[model samples]
Target: MAEIVALFLALCVQLLALPVYVLSFLGLWDPFCKKVFFPFFMEKTMVNYNQKMLRHKQDLFRNMMDFADPSGKLSVLELGTGTGTNFQFFPPNCRITCTDPNPHFKERLAKSMAKNKHLEYGNFITTPGEDLSQIPDASVDVVVCTLVLCSVKNVEAVLREICRVLKPGGAFYFLEHVAAERSSWSFFWQQVYRPTWALVFDGCSLTRAIWADIEKASFSEIKLKHIHAPFPWTPIQAHIVGYAVK
Candidate 1:
């Protein structure tokens, strides 16, 4: 009976991955990935998984909020803000600007914004995380990122962008899934499955040493710690949560 269930689940994965593969090759992966696949992910695994991890990372989230301007008059920019799931965690009345490469997320983001009345929605820029030319230098007070760095082509470039947009003493709060410890069996599995994983998940690399990049960036101070979450959908369970000050 277990073997039968395993085979059935294997078939389901292939069936779901097929459309993503086809759309990727056709160069329409972004819209389809956001419109279809991301929502599917949110419903199937992300919602539940994030709920559990939220408990583990609650203190980190609180620290992020505490860094915000107590007067609720700060500009907060969130890079790679898919569907605006982090909206509820931010402090109320802060100016919120969300940027994502996938334009399709704008609608879903709007829905989330409507529900998150505490956040004052300012802009929804259709820009990738690696570049933030539209935002002025040293103009943002806070930058919030979650589960996003693994997918960018150049983690250094994105970190540089984060540093650029942040005001002096501004805080960058991030929670990213990163490559497992080099000594672990999970690291080996991550390397083996990374290519196909990226193909299906819109270029999300499970092998990025994101914490290392964050540490080496021009941040004045970094308070980060490693963590692990056991989620069956992906092998990249190792994570880091922290805040960096510019």
Candidate 2:
């Protein structure tokens, strides 16, 4: 009974939080997301919730680093750079242009990355992942989005912009948690939890079929790798990791 009550409360909290965060994302509240999910919040809860999720995140990072070019001269761009934790993996010679609509992140990343300012040779625009109109075409060599796809309002528009900015043969490396492939258990939990999950996590959805979405867009050479056996959001056996090239 206690466990059931706890679960119900969790769902309720997520429901209460969702609409507020969504409005913030629509730019009605500006950077409230960072305050809601930054530092300890994301470390504990999912932008979309997952149990056994953290272990897989480390593994996903490993895979992403391995996929990157060794020359370190690749021009890269990342969307939804929440805490800038991925900054450590960028090669010293790599010049990555990162953007996010969160003002808290804009300031924190600038402060945290002050020492390595020289590595970023290009412009870091203040833009959301869904709109890259501010950035010119054919400017990026690698596009990365780690655990961010779930929150974007328009996945197709962002992907279209990604294809446009990526130089021919450039790579798109991503690690995201998505709907599980096949599991009655996975299906049941995801379906049961999705509503409250997206609410508390600021529009992050576990049921999104990201691979299909990416492939449907104008890109070639899509590669996907499933992590472990279940889902990336939970380690009890839930993790998915994938990378694709354009």
Q: Give the alpha-carbon lDDT of every model.
A: 0.80, 0.65
Top-lDDT candidate index: 1
> Against the true structure, what is every candidate's RMSD?
4.9, 6.0
Query: For model 1, which pairs clash?
Result: none
Residues 79-165 of candidate 2 have per-residue lDDT tens digits of: 876656566556656677778765555555665477565456466677888788877787777888877888788888888888888
Reference-based TM-score of each model: 0.85, 0.71
Q: What is the lDDT of residue 59 in candidate 2?
A: 49
Number of clashes found in candidate 2: 10
